[model samples]
Target: MLQIQELVFDAWGRRFFDGASVSIPKDAKVGLVGRNGVGKSTLFKLILGQLTIGGGEIRLPKQARIGSVDQEHPATPVTLLDTVLEADVERARLLSDLETAPPERMGEIYDRLIEIDADRAPSRAAEILSGLGFSNADLARPMAEFSGGWRMRVALAAALFAEPDLLLLDEPTNYLDLEGALWLEARLRKYPHSAVIISHDREILNNSCDHILHLHDGKLDLYVGGYDSFETQRAEKLRLQEATRAKIEAQRAHMQAFVDRFRYKESKARQAQSRLKMIAKLPVISAVLREHTAPFLLPSPERPLAPPLLRLEGVSVGYGGPPILKNLNLRLDLDDRIGLLGVNGAGKSTFAKLVAGALEAESGEMVRSARLRAGWFHQHQIEALDPTDTPLDIIRRIMPEASEAQRRSRLAQFGLGVAKAETTVADLSGGERARLLLNLVAMEAPHLLILDEPTNHLDIDSRRALLDALNDYEGAVILITHDRSLMELVADRLWLAADGTIKPFEGDMEDYARYVVDRARAAARAPSQVAREEPPPPPRAEPPRKAKTPTGPARRRAEAAEAALARATEALAAIDQALLDPDVFAKDPAKAADLGRRREAAQARLAAAEAEWLEAAEAYEAVKEA
Candidate 1:
């Protein structure tokens, strides 16, 4: 357990926190949330002792451990496992040294080894590494060989493997694939240690955290539950706070009027003075507004175009292989809100590029409607922005015909005020750049929008703004995003690119997720059939064991075969009953149908069991005759 008491942090002459106090209980999963530049990361550093607190104290229990993963990593030649295992190298070394020490020194060294080994065990290390989605092969690979994303995972694995009493993870899921992210969520849910994590992914926070900690304007705001609960509660609180502020202002006005009317009257003067004192003692309630403002805009003209805004006719695209996307024929309707989804390196981006006309298909035609107007936002939009251009200049450059007032209004709609619009694009943060790009794209009024990982570097509010704008836009959207919640919010259809094939999913994300889970479960159970096909284990070895009642082994074997046959028959019957259950049948028709077929197969298996039983019986009888 860790407690931060009256902690204050300041950076670059700006106060991030002023006497913010919070306690992280044992095994607590806490989400640190706030708008960008609100010092979530700075607070994390204070907890980890990386930065000195300006005032007050951060208390940790004696012998408490802490781990943190930052946004950057130092370049090192260490392997992934090497970096992780280094957490307890001293303990491991002590144990190793004790193993070879002389007998005369063994007693003292053995005690020391026990003391050191208690803090870290090899099994625990392996479990943490596996839980973080690092394979044995990955652990052996050099850290320098991995991408920045994988290196981030390496850092995360190191933190998790340390088994710290308190863990501070900063955007831990930023670079993870969907599967890795899910694995981390499950691991953190079951983690015995406490954690404070800052992440933009809503689903991760919702599924993993028990509490929400909102950092706003140098104040720590605590919420009882996860992200959704915090949002709902925070909204209500803001509403109430606004109402209270309004009432307080109204009372102050009435008091001022009474003072103005009664200041000259001696009898009323005392009452007026009392009212003044009361007003002075009253706590000033400054209403803290939500960071994001609702975007005000009329829906753009949605002129109906012909069907198939863009069509990929037998498109094949890849770098240097058979093809990452091979001979894919796909069509996008004007009303389609398609989400591009796949694992890393599965060509989701490549498919998006083909659709956007940014890259050419290797062997097939990418056709678009003659009237189609397209806007594309790539993942690296920040890098794509002109460094010399200010946000205002960029807008002017993109839309030469737009008046200054129109440009200012467009910028304001994306949360960029007049002052911020004057700031250079080079100086903006990743989230700001994303917002600017969104604003620029909105002004173009394209009939089709192609965004490749638009939510890549956006915070929660920026993502919400983008999603809202996209939802309200009447354009066909091809969105490639790793944010599952964002996809669910904006995507009306799912397109899965896997193993060089594009599969269309006609249902919502929940249904797609269920289908994926079922497939994964089916794959996991595939080996069960092979195990079942193998012969049973050999009879237990015995050195001429005395048979019960002097019975021969053959008779015992016949009884064992009959028992096995009866067990199989009973199992088949149970399966039949389960398949016929109305609730089960209704909830999952496919599972029920599969089970029904399995029942027929089980009947055949039962018949085979009976045949085997009869053969065993015959063989036993022959043995007895001999």
Candidate 2:
């Protein structure tokens, strides 16, 4: 168990943790969450001993190992798989000692190696890397060959593979794609040791963690269950606190009224003194003051555009060289909310650029309305902001004709008040910059809005605010984000960028999640397999003649039953895949137990679907015979 008692930490010009205390039980998966700039990362630093506390104690078991991914692993000659394996210091030490130790002592080292299951370390490392979006062929490559982001993933994979007693992860999904994030959610759920994860992804917090450690008002409060449960519990707690405080205030007021009325009278002086004493003894309860999140301002377009605001026909686009995306045929309406999904290098950004008009198609026809206006907000815009420029300055350039007061008011509506309006971009928080750009792009009420990873810096509440704005906006949206919750809630249609082309995904987010997991599992098994390509859109055929298809309720019932059976079979297969892993139980018993429960549920669903399908089939056959 990790115990933090009366932790007091003072930082530059302010206190971060003031008498904050929380005890995390062993093997607990805790989600550490708070608003942006709330010192969540600072707490991790303190726990890691990078920062000293002002007062109080943080205790851990003796000789307990703590692991964190602070930065990208160094670029070296070591292979990716070997680098991860080296993270296990005990195993590495044992191997080194085996080289020099006497023959008799070698037996002990070998036994220890067997105990740790060191022989399976390579496969374990490869599996972790594959889950994080690494190709199997990349495992044997030198670390120096990979980029910084890939190296960061390697660092995270190393930490996870080590399985330290206390695992501290700070926004692990920031560097991952949606598929990688989903895989991580499953991986963290079954992690063997205790983990304190700092993440803003709601799905992971709700599905992967068993507890939430909320840091607010310089205090730590542990809540059972996930983020949703935390929100409900915290709300009720504040409500009760407010009620108790109101009651206390009323009693104090009543007693004070008596004292004020009778303090100087000769007959009631003693009674007044007693009343004053009673007032003093009343328990103090402070009123709960909830923090308000600034609202995101996304104005709707004044006039709606006709259907098919943008269209592409056999379009291909890229930089100056070979085309990155080819043979694209897609249509977007003024009201369409397109959620673009793909792995890191699956040409998602290329598609976004093509749609946003940043890059013209090299071949084929692209059509758009003559009056079409597109508001494009990409991550690079934030990175490209001038550090010395203030929000007021930015708005001034965009709204050159508007008065300074008008500019500031617009900023205020975008969540930047008077205080932050003049602050330089360098001094402003990431969330502030994100909000400024997001609102700025949509200020003109364009016909279509293309946002790429818009919620990377915003907190959960702010993300919700954005979601609300998007839902309210009358214009089209093409959202590219790693946040699954945002994607599922905001996008009405899903598009997959794969095999150098863009195409519609026929399934929802759940089906896509299963495909991603299955793909990763395949990669883990076959290290040399290439990226999967979309099957050639079944060769076009002449329109088929209308056949005597079955009709009536029985046919409809049969169709529904068949769909249910497909879903049930897929669910069961996913569970069976996990159970088939030989190392799952040995690595994470908790996950194994959870999988057992899920397997039973999947089995039950499968059986019900099968029975329903059989009955529906019989009914449909009878109707057809009639």
Candidate 3:
């Protein structure tokens, strides 16, 4: 368990979190919810001891273990199993040493070895990897071979394999597909350790977290239950706050009127002074709540789309090989909210590009309706932006017809202040760049919007804003995203791209997920039937066993290695504990430096033990199999 007391974080003379205090209960699953730029990730980093707090304290219990997914993992040519097992390398070394220990000292080390092995179980690592959608065969695959999404999975597996008492996850599900996201949700819901997750996926937060911490306007507001419940309660609380403010204003006005009338009277002078003091003591109500300023503006269509916005006839799209989308025929009508779903490396993006006219199909004809003007928003389209142009300049260029006031107003709607808008496009964050692209596209007022992974870099608020805009738009939308909740909210029909075909399903995203899960199950079961029909491999000849026992000096050397490995394992555990100590890293930078040095020392020891263990194991195996 951990508690943050009067925490304040400031940067460049601006306060991000001001006097925020909250407690994380033991084994509790908590969600950090807020708009973009409200410091959700900042708060997570503060708790993880990755950021220094400007004021107050973060109190964590002693000897607690913590694990987190690094936002960026180095592209190393290590195997997936090697990366995950790296979480507790010293423990693995210790286990190998125990396995090769002499029988005489086994009695002395047995109890300690049992305790260490229980804390570092390889089966737990395997289970976490499998649950996160990795196959047994994938364990030996190099990490460098995986894409960004799969690499994120590897990072998550490493965190989970550490088996920390508290896990701090920042946007953990950003790269996860629906299947992997669901698996993670299930795991977190029943997880024994506590977790504080900062995620934009509403479904994940709702399904996995029991409590919600809403950080808004430099304050932390705690709520019981998940996202949906939090929404309901927050709305009620805001309503009451508004009502109280109104009553206070009325009373203040009445009292002011009384004072104005009686100030001239000598007999009522003392009473008037008392009323003035009482009125001054009254709390000042905020003129506008943060939620009131939210952008509810929807995208307005400049012209009505024709009956059929887009039509594909006998479309065959592919690369150098055979067609991935073969003979696809479909018509997209105006006001259609179509959700495109498929597995990784499928033709979803290809189909989207073909529809957007960004790519030419291998064969067949495509048609766009006469009145259908299209605006395309791709995940990588930010590269098209001029790095020299500021966000404000880009907006002005894109919407040249708009006045200066209108450009600034629109930019502010997407969470960019006047100062931030003046910053160069090259200096903007990934999320900021995405929002700018969206703003540009929205200003075009096209009759059809083609978005491929538009939610990639957006936080929860920006996503909701985009979703709301898409939902209210009078134009047709063809969206390709892995976010199921966004699909459910904004999509009316499902278009599944798989097996070199684009199949249409008439249902919501929930139904689509269910259909996919059922199909995956059926597909998984088919391999067993084929295996049963095939003949098994022939048995190999047995190897001869070893006859002699170990010598005295060899036994002593093994015992010494085992003792060193045990010490290394303990040091690794200490490093894990140090990583979670916010007081050390946030309050005392020197202590953090010392902890880092010790961690490096422990890692060196672990590597040495691993080398010794491998050499000893090789020798033992050669003798036993001789």
Candidate 4:
């Protein structure tokens, strides 16, 4: 059993875990969850004894072995299969000794090899690699040849082959395709050892773990069951906590009022004293307020966008090699909401790039409306931003005629306030840069929006906000994400891109999930698997995503519009507070004029933000229900 008692960790002047406690049974699988910066990874390091704890006791069986995926991979000429098989230290060491040892010790080395099951190590590593979407040819390839994403898969395979007593995996699926992710989840389930995982993928957490561990607000909580169970129970628990706090506050208010009224009166002094004592005896309940997620309010299309804004006929695109998506006929309109599903390396990103005009088809007709302005949010675009350029600089260059107010308004729309707008791109976090990129495209008022794995770097709150914003969008959207919740909430229809075919899927996300599971099972049971252990030539690119039934839009614009208004109102309120501050005005006798200038600038932006909300709402309401 693993026990964490009074675990207190302090770093960067913040108490991450203060007197927090949680215990896992001898062989329990735990899903550790928290906000992005909430120390989930830190906790793993603490358990591994790689970092010193501020205070606490972590008790583990002294004889138990631990294995984890490496965060960084050093460049190595070693083949991938050898790298994974080497994870079995005993086998590797014993085999090395056998090569140099005298004949007298031959029997001893053979005995050790037999004991450690060295003969099966290669096959085991091969099976794990194949499951992670690696071809047999990849097994002999040097580790340095693969990209960082594929390298992580090799890391996971090594960890799995190690077969530790306690396995720790942090975001294992972050780099994996859906097929690979599903394969990994099944392996973890069948794992005989204890495991602790940290992931934002809900399906993995739900399916792989029998217990969920949540760390938030400087505390740790362990709940029985999977991710779904944790969410449902946690929601109810929070609701009850809020209700309880409300009642306590009401009682406290009444008692305080009675005491305030009678405390100074001579006749009521005795009664007031008694009331004050009673208040002291009452249990205090701090407000159980849910932390707010980052605000992300996307703008609606103002232009009159026609249906079928983009059409691809017999289009085929890939990265230099043969086409991954071939002979495709697709049409997208302003009102269409599509979610793309596929395995990793299946060309979902390639398809999106083709649609966005970033990459031309090898040989096909591309028809697009003259007025088509597509807003694309892809990781590569975020990467392409000039590090030295500030948010204002980028916007100013793109829209040279835009005024100071217009530039600031556009930046603020994606949650970049005055300070962030002035900061350079190099200093921004991945999520912040993503928002900036999104704002840059949104300013163009695109008729079609394409998002490829937009939620990969975003937090849960930002993801929720993004989903809400996408649903409220009047323009067409093609979304490719691994987040099932986002797909379920935003995608009205499903499109499956697999086996070099792009076609509409005739089911929901749930059905698609079933299909994935079934496919995984079929692959696991396939014969001729042993033949795959040997090197095979490069094969066809993996298949991509699936589509779902469209959920007709309702008054979603109202919610998103309100969110936009709230953010605008908050920005205006900050300006008002700054303008009203005596300290700010007193900084110089001439500061009042400066303050007035700032206020005027802010008011113009506020007006623009308001105008956008009203216009979007009007357009949303005008859509006739068919």
Q: Candidate 3 at 407: error in angstroms?
A: 5.4
What is the C-alpha local distance difference test score of candidate 2? 0.87
lDDT of 3 by residue, 75-159 (tens): 6888877788887755666667688889886675667657767553555665666556565666677888887778888888788
For TM-score, the strongest prediction is 2
lDDT of every predicted structure (CA atoms): 0.72, 0.87, 0.73, 0.77
lDDT of 4 by residue, 584-621 (tens): 56645577787688778777877877887787666656
The alpha-carbon lDDT assigned to residue 617 of candidate 4 equals 69
lDDT of 2 at 476: 84
Model 1 clash pairs are none
Error of 4 at 467 (Å): 1.5
Model 3 global lDDT (CA atoms, 0 to 1): 0.73
Tell me model 1's lDDT, rounded to 2 decimals. Answer: 0.72
Candidate numbers sorted by lDDT from highest down: 2, 4, 3, 1
Order of quality (TM-score): 2, 4, 1, 3
**Per-prediction TM-score, please?**
0.74, 0.84, 0.73, 0.76
What is candidate 1's CA lDDT for residue 401?
A: 95
